[model samples]
Target: MHILHLPPEVISITCQGLEYRDLVRLRATCRALTGPATDAIRVKAWTVPMYSDCVMYKVRAIGEEEPIFQGYSFKKHFQHHFPQWLEGNLVEVQLLMSLAQEDKEDGLLALKQLTSKLENTHVHVKVVGDYSVDKNEFKQLVEIVATSPPNMTFGIKIYMNGAIGDFFIPDKVTRLCICYCRSIGDFPQFSPTSRCQVHLEIRGGDTDQVLDLFHNACQNSRNLSLAKVTVTVIPLTDPLMSRLETLEFDSVMLVGCLRSTPIPPTKGITCKSMKKLVASNFEEFSYFTSPSLRRVSFVFTDRWSREGNFIGLQRLKKALERCPSLTKVKIQAREHHLGSAETGDYWSDFFNCFEHLEDLEVVIIYSESPITGDCLDTDIIFLGKALPRLHTFCAIDDFGNSYVL
Candidate 1:
């Protein structure tokens, strides 16, 4: 009888199907349903599910039960030199991920049947980003490859832990594609191949002679993401860009494009102290020019991947007209479905390229997922009325909830 005598559109369509610790215990038993249950929990509904300490690179797959991908890796080469590069009586594993251009050749034929018959295991394969690693040293090299023996192939070691936070990242980073590999760890020490490679003992130290005695990657990096690697002397070429003359990055997150090695591109670079830039390929928005950039994050991948957000939006509106100090923005996607109508003019030129960011206040979005689907409330209320120093806008994810666009 008295559901506040109903109608605030039936209490936001019955508290929009409750769940956020039961709508905060029904807005603590009504104080006028706590402003419609905090606007129905910012219109996101609910789903936190774990993982988000502002996420500083993460990944998983060891007795997988769910959680598997948020991206950002190496917590000190997997908590300290990845257990000293896979210790003894050996069988090691390292297989990192980011391969979803239709699971690139069936994930390298399921990792060459998990490394074509192991015989005294020692695996090393790094196809940068997504699902590839092993350690106990990585969970005891996947429990000695489930009790080894059979055509032989068990030991997949890959650790992209290029010291960050004490800074020592000179990981010569070799972008690999494991075509039934042998040796490939993109130097620091580990290169041997007449046919198939395996060797690791960066242990007497020589990762660029300890990153050349810490120049702190060009004096205490504020933020930097340099990909476009190379350093092959024994089979492996093209991928070298250590262009550091000046960089005082504040934030730069370009993540996406790797359905099996496909990122090589560079011939543009300029930064007078980047504030924030997260671009997922548009050929790196003409490769970056931050006029003291403020904040930007656009990463969309899934719907089976086509190299994240390949819609360019007129090359991100000429790279947001060369950052007029972007106020703040973040967009994350996981199931990436631009809600029908053949992507609706790429979200109508992605909301008319932020109406000239004017001095944009804030706008954070994470569609397709935060942990799985649907969060595009009419293109976020049509990008909060097509920006103009947007006061604030929201819609977080990982399914805890977020709304207010």
Candidate 2:
């Protein structure tokens, strides 16, 4: 039967089952499928990377809906000066470093234009860049954004290796994610207590630097409840600990050996409130010891050992032992390894580690080889033996097609 003839509710359900490309095609079939299909598209769009870019180019190109202007991207060919387009109409702007170096005049003009259009809008500005911006330019950009909206929230991510001077920001910002940036020089400089929530992600830095930044954030955010603090740090330490609701660590970098000792607790810090953790790495496997963590995601990279094989799995097993409350676990690993004999054993062992996991997603890079009998049988066996609590088992192969349960 044709999809258009189905009841709206049924069509919605069916649309949700289809791949994103298929849904887009269905939306073009006729008006009967348009409404439900569009809703599905929007929901799916948000989950997809660069959703704003897609909406801006596709939906806007056809004069459907004006896409939300969440941030700006400068056209590279145009002297790298100003943004070629503004994305997402949301009051918040997240400007990545890759798109920040357009000509200063063009960027400033575009910012002015954007502010004019979004004035009186309670906006949040997140500038992600290395500290390559000139002092006056950076100050000017901050001042302009702050002046535009009193209720605005602003944040800056300076690369960990770069130097930055003290700057004032509006008190509207309650959430922040700082990647690879260290040195919180003064603890009281930034008052985070007035805000409702705060998040910090530290990457690619020394353990001392990471601890200093975390401690500074905690000390300044006193008025905020401990539950509002969330931190992600590599080489986890006790001094950097806080009574956070969400605590994450890059395990591959932190856990050097399976026998590595856990960081001891600090005198005033408590991590009992943590609810989520992420362990990612390219080398050795990592683990977490959060008793209250509800979700854990592992991101594996293409790294080879002296024997030309992937890193340790026992470390990962050890990590899983610490997260008893884990309901969801996602493993993003290389596809070739997943289909290999070694990988089959690793997958089996990994599954055995999760006793309470309800949602399991395994994303493997694509490969051209057909699913051999050995690989297929191994996967079937693993799936069959998975935890009884497992409700959603999804495997996305290299080609992006999903095997869902």
> lDDT per model, in order?
0.42, 0.42
Clashes of each: 35, 14
Q: Tens digits of per-residue lDDT for model 1 on 154-224? A: 22334433422221112222222111123222322222211122222122223343233222332333222
State the number of backbone clashes in model 2.
Answer: 14
Q: What is the lDDT of residue 194 in candidate 2?
A: 60
lDDT of 2 at 16: 74
Model 2: ten consecutive residues of lowest lDDT: 43-52
What are the candidates' C-alpha RMSDs? 20.6, 9.2
Model 2 deviation from the true structure expressed as Cα RMSD, one decimal place = 9.2
Clashes of 1: 35
- Model 2 per-residue lDDT tens digits across residues 280-328: 4422223235566566555654333212343444445556555566666
| Deviation from native of the Cα of residue 337 in model 1, angstroms | 51
